[model samples]
Target: MSAASERAAAAEGEQLARTLAVLRETSDRPLSFVTAGAFAALDEGGSEPLAADAESGTVIPANGLVLLYGDGGAGKTTLVLDMLVHLASGEPWLELVMPARPLRICLVENEGPRQLFRKKLARKLAKWPRAAETIRVLEEPWQGVSFRDEAQRDEFVEFVTAQKIDLLVAAPIARLGMQGGGTLDEVAEFADLVADVQRRAPGLAAMLVHHPNRAGQVSGAWEGFPDTTMHVQASGHGRTRILWQKLRWSSLLHGKTTHLLWADGESFTVDEREAVTASTMVDEILAAVLESPGASWTKLRPRVRGNETEKAAVRDRLIADGLLVNQTAREGQFRLWHADDPAATRSELRTGLERLPFPTPEREAAAVPVPPFQRSIGTVERERHGRPGSLVADCLICDHPFSVDDGSPAMRCRACVALTADLVTEREADQMRLLERLRVREALRGAA
Candidate 1:
């Protein structure tokens, strides 16, 4: 054949391929002619769908976007590290019943490296059921690689597809896509980028890690695109909890709390925070009380908001929720607020405070206390822990740790937990006493 004829034939073949691709995209249903049976014999094919009962923790489905967000040091990355180890080792995910298929994961962490990640993974997988060989890692060290414009996204997508990956994990979504929501176009485009990655890989899961907004919501337009969204936050230093902020297949809502604690070495597991309403108001009032013990309502209102009545309503609502109390006063001043009953009250406050309005970083930092003990193993010289008890633990509602008997259940520390019984009885007695004192004071004032 002539060289010119050979070139013409190659061109014709390229044109045919492009035409077929175009038709696939334009079709009402993509690749409709290829029946499910065609792929049935392949190992990747025809497995029973993931069980509806599989979802449990803050994470549910293994497909589409899964977001984990919180303030800095909220352990968003730590939780992701735990999940990655679970995926790599084939351990039963604490909340998920059906294990994800043996999958390849390409994760990008802007802050860490392959060696450190591998070390962490090794530590994690040592406790689980499977060998480390089944998991694959593609690390992008610099933060810039994942968010590189559309061209980079497309290229990365192509690279992932070529690898036949079953899962993709990207840490800190800001590094993976456009950061600011400056305009509607930018927001939509960011959402589209996330959705596009999912669409491009139907069988693969794309889990993006992001820091939560000051209000405790996920950041970026992509936040709304995920099939599941989770908020991992620290209720105390060295102790972090995970909550389901949203889920496509689960009934869990925002602030449905669960805890995950770091164990021996890098191992960690989930602890369910007893389900509670996501009450921002309740949180604010509790925070005010902690910031100022014996604070009066006049003073409390300002803590909720020094200048704004509308914002103060949030605090009033919290009082109505019974997360806070109005302790009657001795003089003309309004009642004071004392922490309500419940050992978990302070923990819940931590949960809510992390979600409050701007300047949240400072507020959250103030809430994280230095853990009393840091050594994972062995005896270190102990410093005197001042106070009346041997172990001082924070009231979950008020963040006040008190000494208690070692063997008792933790429910007693919080004033909120004892609300219905002992704690309420104590509060009522105090209230009556305060009211009597107020009446006597009024009589004196009238006489004067």
Candidate 2:
């Protein structure tokens, strides 16, 4: 036989072998596609929650993809390591619970040097030595292989299955050598590949660490790809905010933002003190409007406690929910009022009230005593802040209500006060170290 014919026959045999292998592997599995009604009727048990926080609910689903993306230096890698340690140790990660038994994890480090990765793993293991047993690192040679290729995908599935990995962690999707610049089509194709791999290895979950685009948004069609998508951003003072951007299957954590403090290089803790809830912001807005009826946007906005964006969002939500009325009071000025107030429904200002103005000194002095609404606003603000006069005051830091003497000047609770002092000392120490480093560098330069 000619050499060309022999080569052709060999290629044909290889393709046939691959086809048979797939068939044999899936022979016991059910059909892939089904009608909507049929899928709903399937007796397959509900998916169990893998990693969850008792207070915050499920984070990583038992058998789905989780996308954690952030800008560079936002501690994405560190946070992932923290999560892996918790999963492997069966401990809660930033209060997110893990299964009772340690989960087998496969960390596919594609973005950094193996030696550097080793140092990170070592630091985490120093705290929880036993977790090292369940955590596995993928071989360096296969790190850069693209999952888009069918053969490579099959090999990866085989590796995970052999290791009995329950969770897979892939760092920085860019290093995976996937084609395209994270456009919708490109991301969808990559997502399809992940689904295929998950199908082949049932009960396996994946966490993909990715970098955001120039706009600081997750690049590509990420909205539909992952079961949960978290956006991490630095919130200053060594705090990172993990916003639950998308929760497709569960509403437990929808629109909730959790804050984590970098306690050390190896782990993070949930900083409940700094974490503000949606309800708190809503109360603040309502109180502000009730305090000053027909308060203009400018006057009302600053009273609501939060960043400008959060305040605006909550205020808009109140307007949408019909709890607050935003009406034009005068040219170029809009007024906000409680929806239940009579003034909020008025088309025009009271006819004679604006005209009867400019009272004499005696009349001004005799003006009606402070109205109930006026007093209520002050009381509400004082109560919220836990002012000296209030019997119980909200902690200035965590907003926890604590007992206080009638005239005591204490603003923060005892716990918050101590935490603040420690944080201040830590900052001062860091500054001193920085100064010492600068002095040493200067002395060395002079000597040189």
Q: TM-scores, in order shown? A: 0.49, 0.61
lDDT tens digits, residues 1-448, model 1? 9999997688557646754775687785645455577766556532332222244422434445666678897766666766666666555556543344445667667656667766776666676545355555555446566443545667667977887766677766666655465245666655556665656666667776777666666655544566677777787856777667677666644435567777665546665444333354456667877677546566766545223554456555655555455443122333334444332233234422111112232343355654332112112222353322133344444444433332222322334333322234567644644554453343334334
- Could you give candidate 2's per-residue lDDT for residues 377-444 as a string of tens digits? 11222344454232344455555544443333345554544333233344564454455445334333
Worst 10 residues of 2 by lDDT: 371-380
Clashes of each: 20, 2
lDDT of 2: 0.69
Model 1 misses residue 167 by how many Å?
1.5
Candidate 2 lDDT score at position 7: 79
Residue-level lDDT for 290 in candidate 1: 69
